[model samples]
Every structure is written in structure tokens, then in C-alpha cells.
Target chain A: MNALDLDRQLCFALYSASRAMTASYKDLLAELGITYPQYLVMLVLWEEGSNDEGVTVKRLGERLQLDSGTLSPLLSRLESLSFVTRHRSAEDSRRVLVRATAEGAAAKERAECVPARIGERTNLDPASMPELLETLRALTRNLRAEPAPVESPDPPAAPLNSHRASALTARH
Target chain B: MNALDLDRQLCFALYSASRAMTASYKDLLAELGITYPQYLVMLVLWEEGSNDEGVTVKRLGERLQLDSGTLSPLLSRLESLSFVTRHRSAEDSRRVLVRATAEGAAAKERAECVPARIGERTNLDPASMPELLETLRALTRNLRAEPAPVESPDPPAAPLNSHRASALTARH
Candidate 1:
């Protein structure tokens, strides 16, 4: 079958591509002693910085689209690694706030080189990254519109038609 | 940050979207007693028909961009479930051929409704399916262009633009 006929479901492509990308990151993350998802949590914390009000598990889950069943154990693993500390919030005892430690923040410097390493490996131009990011965010929004119980609220809106442009500006 | 920011890596969005999509599938596949990857294998064999020449493990790996490490265990699980069979070829003892059984062929009839069900959950339109699939395949090729040892002499060429379309269209 030719391309037109073989166009498998978008789901399959998403599935395979995601796994392939994760596989590429395996060796890199091994050096950091974290899995891909753990690295993502570190990224969120790094971008927000440690002094900013730490993020809650629910908030992190909402952004990452991961449920507690996965996040809880993952958080514990990171905590065991001393990259993050999770504690019950005083004002809201039910809420758990996750904060990165000094060591965790230090990992960012090492990680800054990571994206470039991956970019080099993939041979995708750094200039074209925003376009790719926009497409992915669009796909994520379209796929994630359905709300689940216990899910965190969506992030504040990016400017209309601003996804690619905003990402591009950030790089510079 | 504008579109160019390295902070806005497409990798995160793609990775998260993929995980979210699979999470959506996990619940759906639970009813069918199959996982997401298993469903893809079923689709391939179903489209090819029960008596069709068995798909080789290497070909499956090539199509899925999976290594023997993952595919071997997964295929074994499928065999245990009686959905497929793996046998060594007499002509080429080193080659293993994977063929679906009658049960596996019949499973497709049960699965015909899965695409629509998943679409309902994700709110993705079938018309948009081609574009999403194309983008994924492009990303996969971009990522796969990196060097890796050839697993077999007859490695399937990157399907890229045409493979998915032909395989999928022939079914409809």
C-alpha cells in the first residue's frame, strides 16, 4: 500500500513517535539518573524556580496529564533520590506541594545541554523548534479537552495564534 | 517566550500528548483485554487477513520502530493470549514469522469500533486524522534518521509518507 492508503490512525503515529522520542532520551537521562517523566517534573520546577510557590501534585498532574496513580509513586522515587521534597500543605492538608531541592535546581545546568544534545541527535534545526512545539500543543489541547475528575485546571491562555511565536521568542 | 525558545521544546508536548493519548486508550483496551501496542499488532494482522503471509518480527519492529527487546516480550504475550503465533522459518531458521490465528482475525470485528470510540473520547475528527498521522511519521523519520545497528539484512525501509496511507486505505 502507498502513503495515502497506509495512513494509519493518528493515534498509532502519536504512540510510536512518542516511544521513539523517549527511547532517544533514555541514554541521556540515564546520566542524570532520572527517567523522562522525572526530568519533566524537574523542568517544571526549574522554570518556576524553587522560591516561587511550589507546585502541587494536582497542578503538576494537570499540566503533565498524568494521574496520581502514576505521579504519586514517581514523586516518591524523586524524593528518594533527594531531587524533590513533598509535604502536605499547612493551609490545605489534603494538598501536597512538591519542591525541588538544591541538588534538583543544580541539575538544570546539566540539563540545559540536554535539549541541544537531543536537537543535534535528531538533526532538527533549533530555528524550527517553535513550529513543531505549536503543532504539538495544538494536538495536546485538542486531545485533552475532555475533563476528568481530579484533574487540574488548564494553564492561563497563551495569546491567540501566539504558541509558535511565543516559543520562538523564548529561545532568543 | 516567543516560538523560538528552547524552553518550548516540541519533545515535551509530543511526549505528554502521547502519554495522555495512551492513557485514554488504556481504559478502552481494558474492555477488549488488550493493550494499545497489542491493538496495533492486531490491526496489522487483521488487515493482512488470517491466511496472509505471516508478518515477520523484524518487519513488525521496522514498522513500529521497536527493538527486539520490546517486541519479543510483547509478541510472546500475544502468543500466550492465543491471538498470534510465532514460528521459525524452515528455509531461514534465523527468521521468525508472526501470524495471527483465526481468533486474532475475528478480533478485528470487535475492534472495528475502537477507532470511533477513541475518536469520541479525544474529539478528533477523521478528516484531521491524515494530517496528524503525517506529522507523526515525519517526526518518527526525523528521529530515526540517527544511526543504529541494522537488525536484519532485509530491514523495512522507512515507510515515511506512503506506508501508513496504503496500509490503512486498503482496509477501508
Candidate 2:
């Protein structure tokens, strides 16, 4: 198989694996009433202490690599669920601060089991996990340092060329 | 310093990198009027010749690890763009087949440059590329092997736990 073959490409493998990991989380998160992204947001809040000034949407976007469009709606959903609250920064009106409520803080206890569950799902040995993290971080760093080559002509468009005849057969 | 550190997690690294890669693609894909997921769907169809009945939504979702909710909307958007068509199978009404249009096939000529562009963005030397890919593939594989643990309810969800806080600091 060629290097660019879907199965051969590490990017595809990582991409597929990531998708699968997210899928695995679907059921677990469903009970929490949140999607993967939402769960990630919640995770961030849980770690940081939701009652604090909270994290900013911009900061959240930076960490998550999501833009305002995705993050805004997601935050709204969390707010509606009462998992978080959106507050305007006193110093910077342009910035939004997201703090967790009592209920949100309470949710943390429910989420404690999540990491272990995820660990089990991945079946990743604790020892090798660090190396794997390093590799992914390196790749992500490299990708982020480079500029995007293609620009969309339209604003917020969809996919272009697609066919049904071929399926992405996994080639080892 | 600890394994539980968010920065130390291969999953978070992979997740972050994937989001970064896709975010970078937004401008490029938008210029082409396609989203990142749409581009992937196109990759499967275009590379496969989109000439056959196209790919089934279920098959596409299975390979992509996406459910019907995500796939249905994405396919519908593709259909609106005239890139693909979605129809029910005569034998199985529950099944939906996606086929590309002539225009969709032609779009490939324009997109042939995507891989190279994305590769350049990664800044990985040709020699390092394979190793990087292999490591990511391994990590991703490990993550997909087992069922992820579910979220357990107990104490309230904390936005930032001590472990995660330290991890975040370490990440910076």
C-alpha cells in the first residue's frame, strides 16, 4: 500500500481512532446529557473549579481549537443545562467568563469515573501513554505552526467532490 | 508530573491536534465551500471513483464512527450542494445510499492538492513522517480497542481538580 493510502496514513488512523473514541463516549456521555465537545467543556470547568471567575470562551476556544460559532452554541447549551453560567468580564466587556454553578460543581462527582472509564476503553497501558501523548502533541504543534494552504471561496461551506462507488476500506 | 495530567494524556493531545487540523482546514475548505467532515466524506467518494452506487450512510458512519444524526445532516448538506445524492435502497428502506454527481467527480481535480498542502502544514520531514504516523496510529489503535468507561455519579463535578490543574500548568 502507498503512504497516502487511507489505511496507511497515520492521519487517517488517528482521525478514525479519535472518532471511534468519541463514539465510545457517546453512550457514557448520553447519561450525562452531553455530547463529547460539551463533556470536554464540562471537564475543563470541573478541573478549574467552576465557582471561580471561570474560563473565558476565547480561552476555551484556544484550548479546544474551536471557533466562536461552535463554542458559543455549546456554551449556551451548557448554560441552559445550568452546568455553567456566562458572565461578561468586568474589565473586558468583549470577553465572556464561564463559571460553573453549584449544580455544575455537583456534576463533577458524577464525572470522576469518566477518566477511568475512558482509560479502560482505550486499553492503553499507563506506561506507554506518555510517549503517545508526546507524539500527538508534537504532530499537533507542527500542524498548528504551519499556515493553511487552501481558503474557502464561500463563507462556512460544505464538502465538494464525493462518490459512493468507493468505501474507505481499512488497509493495514 | 502525574499520568492524570491533562497535558500528559494522549487522548487530549490527539483530540486537540485533530481539532487544530480541522480548524486549519476550515479556511481552505470554506474557499472550496466544504467543511472538514465534508472533505473527508469527499475523500472517500472521490478516491473511490464515486461511480458506484456511492457509499451507504450506515457504512460511511461505521467507517467514520459517526452516527445517523451527524451523517444524515452532512449528507443532506452535500446533496444540497449537488455533490452527492441520498436515496433509500429498494431492498432495505432503512438503508440510505449516497452517490456523487458528475460535478462532484470534477471537483476532485481541484482538490488533488489537499494532501500535499496538509502535509506541508505538518512540517514533518519525509523520514519522520512514517514514525510520527506509526506512533499516532498505535495510540489511536489502543484507544479504540476497549469500551471507554462511563461517567459515574457521586460528588459534584469539579471544573478543575488538583490533578487537572497541575496538568494544565504543566502543559503551558
Instruction: Tell me the tens digit of each residue's lDDT in model 1 across B1-172.
Output: 3222324776777787787777777766776788988877777666653466788888887666677998999999999999999999778989998998888777766777667655655544344455446556776776666633423454335434432234221223
After superposition, which runs of candidate 1 have C-alpha atoms over 4 Å from their true positions?
A1-7, A124-131, A146-172, B2-7, B27-31, B48-52, B92-95, B116-132, B147-172
Candidate 2: give its CA RMSD in angstroms: 11.0
**Alpha-carbon lDDT of model 2:** 0.66
Task: DockQ for every model, please.
Answer: 0.29, 0.23
TM-score of every prediction relative to native:
0.73, 0.70
Model 1, DockQ value? 0.29
Evaluated with TM-score, which candidate comes out highest? 1
Off by over 4 Å in 2: A1-4, A30-33, A49-51, A148-172, B1-4, B30-32, B49-54, B85-97, B128-145, B148-172
Q: lDDT tens digits, residues A1-172, model 2?
A: 3323455555576677677677767777787788888988877776664349789998888767778999999999999999889999999999999988888788767766666777765654454454445546666776676563336443222121111111122111
lDDT of 1 by residue, A37-136 (tens): 8988887777664575788999888767778999999999999999999989999999999999988887877787777656655554455455456656
RMSD of 1: 7.7
Per-candidate clashes, comma-separated: 33, 36
